[model samples]
Target: MLKGITENAVQSLIASENPSDIQFDIVVIESNKKQEEYAYPCTRTLFPRKKFGFHKYFNLGISKTDSQYICLANNDLVFHKSWASEMLRAFDADPSLVSASPACSIHHPAHGVDLYSGIHEGFEVRKEVAGWCLFFKREMLDITGKLDEGFTFWYSDNDYINTIQKHGLKHALVSSSIVDHLESQTLKSKDEKEQFKLTHNDRFYYEYKWGKRSLFSYLNIKRKLFFR
Candidate 1:
């Protein structure tokens, strides 16, 4: 499968796996791009028929699917052969595990959550996983509820971690469930200045929703954001 979330990624997902119970509900935020039909029996939605922030799409997708296990994945990912099986096994092995994300050795530095590091393989409990792909049981919604759609583009992952922690839930990174994330591969509809402004604005909202970060901490994140 293609490594980045794109139209071809859906086709690749279908091509990689054998006939199974898995289903896809493709949600496009804006309808400016051309749409095509997939061979699989799936639903498609052009939400708001316009561009919006990330969490809104995910919330809408969850509402549209009734699967017991839902994987909120970005379109740009290359699913290794065992990705699905390993993720499911982690949940099966730990009934208390409420959420998970497949591991990527090359990580984009995440702030505000303690995570397991230096593992080439195996499952490890974590405070959070990168937001690129988050998998969890449907019932988790009962406790954590839908992702806070207020996170227009950033810090929703941190908010989710806070939610999981508040509810005494465990989030894990399943190393064997490998999915290569194409980081920042999604097309940016906004210009650089506007994107930067929106990101900082989101950070302020994050602090307001959670708690304040020190000046140094905010500066550190700013440096990484600029360089990354």
Candidate 2:
């Protein structure tokens, strides 16, 4: 599943109007023994096989890259020609921006709400940049250390944004940089109950880490009060 989507993502890069302006390295973090092949133009590295988790692998990828800029994209995304340049412009325009991502339908619901609702011409500074397609300078890694391994999979993005903001940095969505995201395509084949459990646990962990009540707990109490 990821193999195909990753291939499409690479194709999108090659199809870009200014393909030559974009250079990238592919880092594949395999969770299984099956080795996927890439015919893309960039150097490729496959981390040792491990259980599926975003933060660990993302950190591993970051460690491997020596570029001044780093852009992380989920395998299930297709980039637009302007995606890289627009995000670059945003970073250049705002020295305070620690990270930036393209506006996409399949982004964090709150961050991309305007784009998903048909208003997509302007940028937005967001509380969190979705993990699916994130762009940032290497300097941010110095400040945040790394994505919290405590959030091995979920809420890592939230934790990442929070960490950056704590250091007086911000992230944004460059509206002109659009991408096609097939959300959760990476987990489509996973058991629903297991997925729910991870999400449920991660939500609570995130809330606790940030010193807030979990949304589920708050909603449950609200429901009980309403019924009473």
Candidate 3:
């Protein structure tokens, strides 16, 4: 898995179960000016400037991947040992499934469904999906284009999901595979004003592409911006 690592969470991941099965290609996204010697052998480190957003960093990792199936995941997510195998089975069962996301308990109010609970035994269309543990066919890069660089930190995944739907591609939840997500671990440090900008920009992009936004979407965006 490709993880954008901050110094804080690296130790916890190492201590988690079955770390050997996980080949962590860790990319450091911030504050490495004087820390050249601290890099680990297996860890692939990147020290991006504050101006570059998570989408840019994520795209950097995606560009380097050679696997036919790619998992674009966050560092805070912990996976089951069987995650890779089960997800592959789901994708292999239907070549039309452009993407398959892991089911989790966390619900985004905008989508009006608990993401993990929405997983079915068969294929289906999904309105929204989280960036954490999003598995996609490599060909999707050529089909929908890369993540929108215009987005600094948020909504890049949502934009990609929108593009997937536009191409009539299908996405589903692989119910058998699960990942524990430590929500907002990366973006939790941002102040209210910066957070608001992220939310507003996300909503604007959705409205620009879809032409209409749902009430749940509006409220969710507002909640993310001002409330938390």
Candidate 4:
């Protein structure tokens, strides 16, 4: 977490209206070994992990705790006071819900979802929630297993939903809970040229595992890559 991004995010949760009985824990899977510390609420553990891959860190983080409810959140999110309470209420109301994501109006436009725009009150069932923040029951891990570590960075979310749905699990977008996504903060730190290369690498791997998105989707990348 560059700057005080992770600290700010954690403190925001401490300032929020959390569930009374729920013991909020934080497991920091650091992208680099900066060894920064924060005065966060509840139990906290910091794991210095310089390696990349979304699932690799997430799976490791989850293993660090035994909380019934697990949330995989990005470092750049500023959570609203109502976010935690509202998200838990949704899970309590629907036992069938395996995973849910909070709505974030402050997310970057490139994130592809204008959270508050065209969104309605309460929960909206869907095949997938936004990748920035994912909240789910720990039992979900038992069913879907660890997300495919094969996904280097991108497409882990896509693969997660595919496995989730195949197991008859459902996910929802919790509009009542809101947060801010300083979208792709880590990716933004990298040069644009490198970003494209990494994204294409993930895309190629995704297609290799799941087949082409569609016949035409293959043409979206370089023709040389497509033929190769």
Candidate 5:
């Protein structure tokens, strides 16, 4: 986990899970100013950080991971106790499955909760994969390459999912696996401009990828907005 120094949510997640079974190596990437105070036994990377964005953080994490199966998750996501086991089973059942995501429901009322009901079904390539919790085989890295660094703010997950589909890889949601997502904890938008920019980025990604070429394209946009 390449967690930012300010992420207290990581501590909450660590406290919730069983230390023995779910134990894995952690790599905390912190700002240079926080290097001394946040230091722990786990691997640490300190940089003169300045708004590197989500894609950059993801790339940094991917570079550090050597495991065959890698999970890229937000620090604010709280996994169900059996999350790891269920995800493992899903992956084992189908080697072709490039990515597996948990059934996530929003934690904060401001983020809205009912938006997630019955959203995790039907395995298809064109569908969006929520970045909050994504588990995938390392082979995908070799195939689809890294998240597009051009996406400094939003739609990085959409770009990745599109790349995965282009490579003919499959993805599914582990219906039994659940996660409580404290949505947008780290990237909270405090101004209208930030919110508008995020929306613009999302729309740009959709238009660039789909381009109104098919009848289903509009439906895809609606599905992503309402369900994904």
Candidate 6:
């Protein structure tokens, strides 16, 4: 399912609006040797068998690009042709908007249909943008540094949001941009024991790095500030 989604996503981008105007590259990151054929169509495909951490792969990809703007996308997303252009327009609209994301219709764990409606109705301001389909200037990376490698997986996006906000940078949800996300499609399929160990370790590492009393403490604050 994940491989099929990746292929479809690549096809969608190839078929998206104004393909000639949007000069971009697609980088696919995977762990299995058998997946090389699946990722071969991309501009560049990486296969790192070891558990080098999520942020490491992100940084590796970013390091390979010289584009002014960078978008970190997940494999489970189905992007429209206008997606890149819409996100670019948001950055163009406000110089201070350092990072942005499209309002997803089917964000998992919590459906984002309402959030999408609100954003589409012109209420796009957001405290922390999800990493699922995130866009940002390269300068933000220069300022805040690469996504904290310590995060490995969980809370990395939150860490990014907090870091940039502390530096007076801003983020938003680009209402016009759109993507259909099959969220947690891969992670949900993982063995429960492995998933639990990774989740627990990452949560503790995140709390330690951010000085949180507990995982719920961070969630409690985010719920009030953003969900409200």
Q: Evaluate residue 177 in candidate 6 and report its C-alpha lDDT on the 0 to 100 scale.
A: 80
Better of 2 and 5 by TM-score: 2
lDDT of each: 0.65, 0.68, 0.62, 0.71, 0.61, 0.69
lDDT string for model 6 (1-228, tens) is 667777777777666667578877878777555654544474587787656567778888898889898888777878776878877876777787777778665652153445434233221223226577778899887788877777666666767777877787777776568776776776786788656654555666677567866667765654554443
Error of 4 at 92 (Å): 1.5
Pairs with steric clashes in candidate 2: none
Q: Give the clashing residue pairs of candidate 4, or none.
A: none
Model 2 TM-score is 0.77
What TM-score should be assigned to candidate 3? Answer: 0.69
> Candidate 3, after superposition: displacement of residue 25 in Å?
5.2
Q: Report the lDDT tens digits of candidate 3 across residue range 72-135.
A: 7766766654666667777778777778777644433334545335355323333236566678
Candidate 1, residues 31-132: lDDT per residue as tens digits?
234445333224364535446667877787778778888887777776666567777887888898878887654552343222234222213223237577
Ranking by lDDT: 4, 6, 2, 1, 3, 5
TM-score of each: 0.74, 0.77, 0.69, 0.78, 0.69, 0.81
Best by lDDT: 4
Q: Write the per-residue lDDT of candidate 2 for residues 60-145, one digit (tens) a residue.
A: 88888798898777778887776777777777777777677777745545453655232122232232355677788998888878
C-alpha lDDT of residue 80 in model 6: 73
Model 4: residues with Cα > 4 Å off, grouped in runs: 18-21, 34-45, 107-128, 213-228
Against the true structure, whose TM-score is highest? 6
lDDT of 5 by residue, 120-220 (tens): 43343223355677888888888778877666556666666767777778887666566667667545633665565555555555565556335466556
State in Å the error of residue 200, model 1. 1.3
- Give the worst 10-residue stretch by lDDT in candidate 1: 118-127
Count of backbone clashes for each model?
A: 3, 0, 1, 0, 0, 1
